[model samples]
Target: MQAALQAAGQGWHVFPLRPGSKRPALHGEQSCPRTGPCVNGHLKWEQRATTDPDRIRAAWSQAPFNVGIACGPSGLVVIDLDVPKNKSKGSSDAPDGATTFKALCERAGHAVPTTYRTRTASGGRHLYFTAPPGLHLTNTAGTIAELVDTRAWGGYVVAAGSITPTGTYESLSGLQTAVLPAWLRTILQPTPKASQAPATAVLGRSNRYADVALANETRAVASAPVGEREGTLLRAARALGRFVAWGDLPRHLVEQALQEAGQAAGLTAAECRSTLRSALNWSIAHNQTRRETA
Candidate 1:
């Protein structure tokens, strides 16, 4: 066993399990008791027994759920997904009980949870729920991804941002099912408001991470010399805004455009969805016109 384990790690932190002496793949099994007994152990379990009341209270305030996805000197990221209430649309609920992006197979229905580790010594756990029949992954994935981290127990999908995590299986051979119920409690301990706007850093406009294309576009508009547009500035602004809305661009970038468009462009993030709706109609009409001309 030691020989095989060492060979597998190719000389890494590999430990050989001596029948019943090893811990039960700790994280995958243990989890915040707020749910049920450790299901396939995907919640990435952790429990810090602190005697300090204030410290305990403070720690507890982070989230009723423990298990985060991170990679720091501490070996994992310690994230508290408890966003401010106002930012959450005045709801006391934390995103899917901090268990969104549950990892599962497409044909296998709902699987285990998802998780991810970050460079910032932080990680997140993605909670997976069964995708409704015929529902595309894009539909509710954004909302879920926006709410939870990707590396707690069952790391979520940070890139594809689809149904995510490919899921946590019980045994490499056997499949298991885990269900996360909705949180039903209001009047949560008061949390400080997120300053109407949480810190929004204007990341550089380099195509460093090409996947962040939407972010690049928003950076362009956000830093755009508002006066650069000629006669079609309005149209350009409108088109840009519509493009953002029609596409599932990053939320921050979408807002950046809305801010750049300014009042004259007459766009608001909340009201921007209609822009895509209108663009779709225009595209349909233009297609029909092209057919006629052809």
Candidate 2:
């Protein structure tokens, strides 16, 4: 561990990986049985024992500061501590079960400060953070897990190359390291500032995709609730504006899964309409919650 930190000091790329390399950061053994075939055709996301140890290490070498740890496969399900700034320095605008990530960067010395945010599967928020300078990035990752707010779940996948915006890993450019700084033994997220977008010279808006982006967001706002036909319903709602009515919602055959989820419930037409209304309401609330937390 000390050598890796020294290498980082010399600007040599390092990857702080576990023995199995399924995760870049070290996490105590935590596993749950998933008997059926895993979604990626494996048994479970966290079943590190199933992964080829060689591949886990290989993925860690993508670039300097990129570390690999054995995540039990389901990936790290961290409770992100990222939050927007409070309305005032102490206006008590903190989120429910939330912590601020912005403060950590300001406090981190000799480190290129970074803050990250991601959406949870439940439309909640997740925050990303680079390990402080001189500490192994993987080590920082491990520490942050403990610092996460109560909203987080301890176990999460630590696979590399994942585009999860909520995840934080190695350095991307400019005097980067494959590992985090060794100096930083531990860190906790900071309190947020305000929620406004940074007030830099507003570069002319990227208007080319404005229409499409709004449509997509609104469509996201209208998609099914958390526990519904998540994939199919989202696709169907995305095709909403184009369709004249529910019949046209399919707009068809995107998948063999058409309304079967609720059909077995034998809901009446009124019940269906009421259920959809409820879902729409739920989606809007969820999106709003996300926006506020984000």
Candidate 3:
């Protein structure tokens, strides 16, 4: 109860999670009784989360419920830095989220900002930040880098006092939550449709084979199903990368086309950018010899 109240004191809405688990304790939609709070309709966890002290007290009194902080209502964008689950065979140097995030910051010519931080049960870190006003950023998985995720609208975070079977979540810093940095926000923000012009305008139709390949690959990425979208985007980027290396297509144009296609298929801007960049780099490097001989 005190744990939920502390989160509520920070102006963050709180909800109950199952004791010793991260799953929500509130009745799910399928089993909603539609009584009392749900008199009109089935209220989802996000909708039912509240900052009211009475409600928090009532809910927590029944059991030692874990606290869940709803990010959307709280106006927070939490950057989750996770540790690698398991080391690959013969590789003891698996990169963790903090290391990758630090590299990402250095590449952008910035240092990681000090903010309200928490240590998760699984030995992961959560860096809390205030969201930019009026920007409704959605949750992302591996959008910024491997093991880095951002949760905003439609997502929730376990409060600092919550405990799971693995371990307990504990606060690491008392520092104020920082406003999300501009460079990081730029990566998360979606590209406006008005700015995305047709690929033909950028790439032109001079090489029919290259043009056809670009169109086909991008189309495949855009139409890929949810489970296969990321792989499709990576494959498309790799397939088109050779054309860029061979001087048959411009790198920027190919990147732009594929990025837009990946976003269209529900991939986040950061995810597309990261995947496209790595895939293209590998494809270009590996195909350099073939390009030189041609």
**Which candidate achieves the best lDDT against the true structure?**
3
Q: Which prediction has the highest TM-score against the true structure?
A: 3
Evaluate residue 169 in candidate 1 and report its C-alpha lDDT on the 0 to 100 scale.
14
Alpha-carbon runs more than 4 Å astray in model 2: 1-45, 48-79, 82-92, 95-99, 110-117, 121-154, 157-178, 183-294
Error of 1 at 213 (Å): 12
Candidate 3: TM-score? 0.70
Q: Give me the overall lDDT of model 1.
A: 0.27
- Candidate 1 regions exceeding 4 Å error are 1-94, 97-99, 102-147, 150-216, 219-294
lDDT at residue 191 of model 3 (Cα atoms): 29
TM-score of 2: 0.23
Candidate 2, residue 123: lDDT: 30
lDDT of 1 by residue, 1-294 (tens): 222221222211121122222222233333344353334333432232112344434443543222221111112211223233453365655544234323211111234334321221112332223322332222121212234322222222221111113222121111122222211000011112213211232223212222354344344434433222111222223333323333323434544444454333433443334333333333333322111111
Ranking by TM-score: 3, 2, 1
**TM-score per candidate, chains pooled:** 0.19, 0.23, 0.70
Residue 121 error for model 2, in Å? 4.6
Each candidate's number of clashing pairs is 36, 41, 0
| Cα RMSD, model 1 | 20.5
| Cα distance off (Å), candidate 1, residue 245 | 24
